[model samples]
Target chain A: MTTPASSTADNHAWLRRQARWSPYELAFWLAVLIPFWVFPTYLTLASQIAITALFAVSVDLVLGYAGIVTLGHAMFFGLGAYAAGLLTKAGWGEPLSGLVLSGLLTALVGLLVSFMIVRVQHLALLMITLGLGLLTAELANSLGWLTGGTDGLQGVDVWPVFNHFEFDLWGYTAYAYALAALFVGVAAARRIVHSSFGLSLRGVRENLNRMPAIGSPWRRHLQIVYTISAGMAGIAGAVLTHTTETVSLDSLSFQRSADVVVMLILGGTGRLYGAILGAAIFMIARDQLSDMNPQYWYFWIGLLLMLVVLFMPKGILGGLSGLLRRLGG
Target chain B: MSEIMLATQSVRKSFGSLEVARDVSIELPRGARHALIGPNGAGKTTLINLITGQLAPDGGRILLEGVDITHAPVAARVRRGLTRTFQINTLFPDLTPLESVVMAICEREGKAAQFWRPLTSHGDAIDEAHEILARLRLADEATRTTRHLPYGKQRLLEIALALATKPKVLLLDEPAAGVPKDESAMLFSVIDALPEDMTILFIEHDMSIVFTFASRIIVLVAGGVLLEADPDTVRSDPRVREVYLGSAHGH
Candidate 1:
């Protein structure tokens, strides 16, 4: 029914649009399509990437956009994991409701913590956040009865997503679920950073002293963003708990906090897509290198991170963009 | 009857016996085009900071519209319509002038909390931002990030930001400090054209600029008021002449 000439022209236009894709957009599509083209065995790896990216992006919301450096973001993640686990144990194993309930509960804790968090800046803020994360980890460890005492939360059960897709052993459903949540999280963060409130946050980041004269309560703004960011992190934690059907003390560990921060910086901070790119690269590298040499994989990661900091302070996406610019676009 | 737009009563401040303000009191009525003149380090900026609630006074009351705001926070004071600029230009280095003005306008209108909508969707804020940039003759540079602007333009943008808030009491600390004399004229002309009811208190080192913009001038020496009088009287007062104008003429 279509003319040959018109069809050829349409094909040409489509090719042009494809050629014009930003590296981040290209990467996003590739990530979304991993299950179709990648080995079926790597599907769980894809799920891990998606969940870790969600966590990294939430950290970016605070560190990258709001300029609040934190090493305690894992506290929110752990709170969410525990909340989802407890909900499932109580016979309410609905995935969507679990995600929301955990997110809100983590947000409430984040809001309370932010009062103290926003009062400090720079090194003090960093130290306080780190301390808070460690304290939560210790609490989970000591209160084993509630959190399974370092053995991890036992017997967490997740219902099939919407009663349609069973969580297969090959992780097709889990990967899909995590990717969808990541997509929604990225979309929401994009909306926030492009809003008027987001502009004011950057203003506060650039110059805190000038904010008062412009009639902005910068502390209040920082607090609100921190709470929202923590909630986003909570969603990531809930996703991991539901997919694996287990919650562990590692969820609250400082190492988890540090690793995500590293991943965020590796992919670049401030921009949302950096979270996805960084998480994929970090998790995949860890998986492969650890399989190759289980004892020294961290050495390689540390080396890679050093190289990134030294040569590309802006991270992977930022470096790529700069390269593209210098090469005359 | 004209009422006091801003007043400070016997405010005292000291940094470990290095007194910056010693029992300084001022009553600036509405529409008063006043200037605070002093030699360097006489605490002209400190007084502005005190009135704007940046630094708490050790002793005294600051009242805005006869309501005491001595204990108010900086944001609260700005919301009550008191705002100031700095001797050194302070602006969001990453934001464009249009974005900067839009943010100020939004914050003033209590729209800074709306996080769901795109900033460009606020048609009223965007329109008002454009109008303000045009008034300040910064329309051409509206989209340029403020860090890349010339010093004179940055200074103008600082005033533009303060103006966007529709402040009842606008305090500009050395608004023309880094600007060339020729451009400073242009800057003052813009300030000159603002509504007459907006009480303005500016600190300036240029005697010509001060005499032209301010109806009354208050001179300070060594952290204390030397004289507060109409321009002509302050210009001729021997005490002011010995303390400030002497140094001015000597230069």
Candidate 2:
């Protein structure tokens, strides 16, 4: 029999093997600083892309990791947007605190809704989420006084972050802010999905019937992931709201939710860095393609999406990773 | 006499008009190796389900270590050391055998809720999972995705998952139903070698395997216990010869 020392070494080696950072993650972190050097005037666009990527990652947490299909994820995003906007308008305009508050509010909403959402699966879950998103939109439309209705909540000015970096018209500070949120959100989510709780979520996803038999509190795991995902989505929303200095009904629209889901699929679901790549490819493509063909940009976007879904079902990043692995690189 | 670790009192279950378990009563003493046997549709699996809290009995109470647990949830029952395995293999098909077992071990250790720490950091759970896979002779396939494993090995992996929980009363619906004849021996041998402190109640159709491994046999017919006796007595009963074992012995 081999010595225990040899076996422990083998286990350590396996752990180290899993610990290697993917090139995608390294490039993403390094790429966060690129807008500052190359395209200072395009900081607004870069910040929007970062915020959108973080939203997609949040959706990926529940949809990809926890296996909860949702069509109303933007409800949390919108709530966070409105919360930040309202907080600033209400004279408590600390940007970081506003972000935290908005995220917490969205998470609280998620916790409450998870009672109904987690109990159902698949079609029912999708419909309930859609209904909730539409309901929130309708509420915002009707509550014209607080939400500012069709015109959006106007006259909201975000205070400079940390009383230091001023909000510039070029969006340099905003880009940094969104990237920081993404970095923290990604770190926390990566830690979570690699943990035992995350494994149990995969266990629930793979065999929900046997999860309870294995002594897992399946419902609780789902609720925790759902709530955390909601909070992350909220942070993305708050960042966008603070960056743009407005919270609009568009934040609550079905289009926003659907777009994030598309971003997740385009990036791949379970891989953490896929969301960033997906959002980047999507946002950048829409930006560039729309500028070239303002009237028929959807044509090009739709064609690209169809090709992606047809050929790369695991999403663009997952396909690239697989290809790289097969090449023995 | 050993203490009664599990008991069901006149438990009854009905699916619409069809009664699956009719006033079934049972007592499982600690460390006992008992096998439940009957023909098809005998409510053997239903009885296991009721004991494991998968279904609530229509009529009586289920007691675990003398405390009523008829109303407990499946997870609560499992945490109380009463665990079960499905007749059909149920496992995380995408996870490696080692990961699946480690998750089960973590669930048992109440560390499955630890989200911030990487699961690999729980070196104890990983080591324990490795040891269990080795015991089940599945160490070679430990890192292989369960879906890629042979069906017989999947069946053994099912048992390995149950053993990871360290259940006080392990209720196996059918541990060898789909395993090959040769592999079935290896599976039962592992079951036969389990520590005597962990009581086992398994449902099996294979009389040869049951008679060899089970110290006591409970025969069910039409959702009721027809007889409960030592394996020799059960094999020798005239009624068993008539209703179940007749003409099939070929021996």
Candidate 3:
């Protein structure tokens, strides 16, 4: 019989093995970096993909891991966008600091909102989030003097990266900045999900009733995750505002929230890589399909979503992992 | 007498008009192996829920080690050395037993908020979880997903999770509800092996398991305690025989 010490060592090794990066994961990250050198012309599209991927990861933190059903995620994103825009418009134009401040501000709002959000579940939760989203959108719309309303927030200026590289017309700096933020956000999210705290969140998602018995308060866990998720999404939004130098009503639109949900579903929920892959695939498909057939592009997107749901049911990443398992077996 | 670890004084609860628990009072000293046996809807589970803070008692006081905790939340109760297992198996189906137990241990240690470190960094928690699983004869199955485990093992996992909290009082609601007869004996054997200082109140239907494992039995009928005595006394009591054991034996 193995000694207790040896068995524990085995368990430690096994846990580390589970968290270690596989070759496929490494390849995916390498591919994320490849667009900078291999496809310079697509830098603008690539940057958007990076920003959306970060946003999708934020959604997955709540929706996929915590099992919170929300339709108003864009509230934070829009908040971040406007926060960055307003900051720049007011002359605090440093890009990195602007991003950090926007994310922090969004997190504060998320913490406040989570007090109400964590109290409800299922349909009520959905409605509260939806109402919050709409409420914010209308608040921004009505505050024409501040947010510029339908005209969108204009004259927002962003400074250089650490007083070094300048924001260029070719989108070089924007792509690099957004990609760096995505990497950091994704890494932090990955760390959170694989930690003891992350496991508790999964436990909350799987059996919320059981968490209390095990000494983990379900609502507190939900609130913490929601706040963190909101902050990450806010960062993504701030990145967009910085790159594009514009903030429109679309930032907080219901459609933006709905589209992020679709992206998460397409990529898989729960898995960090799935969110990134989903965001990348969805954005690429939108860019390509809309170019090929602008008016009917959504038709193809709908078809793809249906096919993914029917065959995979777990999202593209889930499907791929299942297939790999079968082949190995 | 041993110090009282858990006590409920005149606890009462009702769903609209149907009174499920009626002015019930029960006390458990440290290390007491008490079995709560009653017929269907006799408030056995309700009493457990009331003590564990799952449902508010209509009127009464609950004390844990002499501290008033009548209105504490479920998680707070757990953190204060009170824990329970569901009658129905409630588990994280996608997580492995090791992960579930480690998370439980983390909750107990207040390390659940350690978001920056990797799970493997908690080597001590992992070791403790493995030991707990091993104690329940689940060490081999620790790495397997909880959903795919045999029904008997899943029930054991419930006890394992409770034990992870180092609970001073464990309220188990029909822990062997759906397990096969042969397996439940082993399940109780594991419970029997738990620390002797831990107080355990379990609800079980099987008389043999109850008699074999429990040092004392509390019989309830129509939301009131019929008798609270040692196994031998409870066995000979005709009222218990008539109300519960009689009908229980008939099946």
Candidate 4:
């Protein structure tokens, strides 16, 4: 029999063989890094890509890892945004503290809501989230005294980050910060989905019956994932609010949730980088198209999403990755 | 003397009007390799479910050793050393065989909820999992994804998974079902080699294999035990022949 030393060597060699990066992949990553060094208007676009990518990644935790389809995800995102906004407008406009409070407050809300949602399945889960988001939006509207409602909570001056780095109107600091957060979030997500607990979660998804047989408490497993994914969404929201320095009730809409699902599908579910690519591609297209045809952009985006669902059910990156593997690329 | 490891006292279950399990009492003494033989629609799986606390009994008591577990959930029963495998429902498709076994072992080790520490960092659990996989002769296919494994290997993985739970009372619902004849015998040998103190109850329609391996045979007719005795007596019992052995041969 071959010794352990030889086996370990073989494994390392196999991984090395697999590490050959495609030219397109190299180019894409290089472009992402370019915004970090080059000073240009690409900063705002990069910031949008980072925040949107993080939000998409959080949504994928539920959709891909735990296998729950959500249409009311904006509730957490909006909660985070407004929580930061309200605290800042309340004469406590510290960026560091506002970000922390945003995540904490949204996490508490997510915990309460997730407990009620654990028993719901499929369309009920979607509808309940939708209703929850709508209710939150309505509260924000009625209590404009707190949320600033439809006009949005504006004129909020966030103190410099760390009491030193002032909010850069040029968007450089915001883009770099957002990109770092997204990178860390995606990397952490990758670790969880690759772990044993995550594997058991997939087992729970495949067959609820199988989990108990394997000595897993299925409901508790689902609840844990829900709570963690909710917190991740909250972080994404806090990051978005931090960069924009403005909060809008638009953050809590069914469109936002549906858009994230579209992003996940556009990149591919169950893949980390796919979420990033999907969010970037989606936001870029929507922004460019809306610039040209602001009123009709929604119709075109919807048409394209349906086309993707029909023709490329795996999402763009998912399909491309599979095609590459099949062709020995 | 054989010690009683698991006992059910007139346990009853019904799905509305359908009486799937009725007034069932079972005893699996420690070290007993008990065979539950029945024809189609004989409620063998339901009996297994009741014992493992998957479906709560409508009316009777389920005692594991001296402890009453009638109201206990399936995970609780698993923790109490009662582990079971589904005939067809169990097994995760996308994970590697090693991953599935590692998850089971993690549960039995009682620390599956730990989020920050990666599972592979736990050296002892990995070693224990390796040992369990080795027992089922699946060490060679450890890294292969579950969906890629052949049907027989999947069945082996199922039993291997149950083994990883450190079960004292093992209930297998048709462990040999859907597996080919050669593979069934291989599976039988694996079960035969299990620790002698373990109490194993399994449902089987394969009478030849059942008669060859089982020391005790319990025949279930209509959600109730018709006969519970040694294999020789059960093989010759007129009622067993009439309800079970006869129908099985009709095909």
Worst 10 residues of 4 chain A by lDDT: A1-10
lDDT value, residue B82 of candidate 4: 92
* Structural RMSD, model 2: 2.8
> Whole-model lDDT, candidate 1?
0.87
Q: Which regions of candidate 4 fall more than 4 Å away from where they truly are?
A: A1-30, A36-39
TM-score of chain B of each: 0.97, 0.97, 0.98, 0.97
1 versus 2: better TM-score goes to: 2
Tens-digit lDDT string for candidate 4 (B1-251): 67789998988888888887779888889988999988888889988888887777889888888799889888888888999987994787876566677788877776676655565565666666667777887766666667877888888888988888899999888898898888899899999999999989988888888999899998988888888999889988899989887888853
lDDT of each: 0.87, 0.88, 0.91, 0.79
lDDT of 3: 0.91
Task: Please identify which of the two predictions, 1 or 3, would achieve the higher DockQ against the true structure.
Answer: 3
CAPRI-style class, candidate 1: acceptable
Candidate with maximal lDDT: 3
lDDT of 2 by residue, B113-153 (tens): 89988877899998998888888878877777789889988
Instruction: Give per-residue CA lDDT, model 1, range A189-249, as digits (tens).
Output: 8788878888888888888888998889888889999999999999999999989999999
Q: Can you list each candidate's DockQ?
A: 0.32, 0.53, 0.61, 0.43
Candidate 3 runs further than 4 Å off: A1-6, B249-251
> Which 10-residue span in candidate 4 chain B carries the lowest summed lDDT?
B114-123
Ranking by lDDT: 3, 2, 1, 4
Residues forming the 10-long window of minimal summed lDDT in candidate 1 chain B: B242-251
Predictions in order: chain A TM-score: 0.91, 0.95, 0.96, 0.88
Off by over 4 Å in 2: A1-9, A292-296, A299-301, B246-251
Off by over 4 Å in 1: A1-27, A326-329, B249-251
lDDT of 3 by residue, A1-329 (tens): 11123366777877787788789887887887888788999999999999999999999999999999899999999999999999999989999999999999999999999999999999999999999999999999999999999999999899998898888988899999998999999889989999998999999889988998988977888899999999999999999999999999999999889999999899999998889888888899999999998899888878989999999899999999999888887
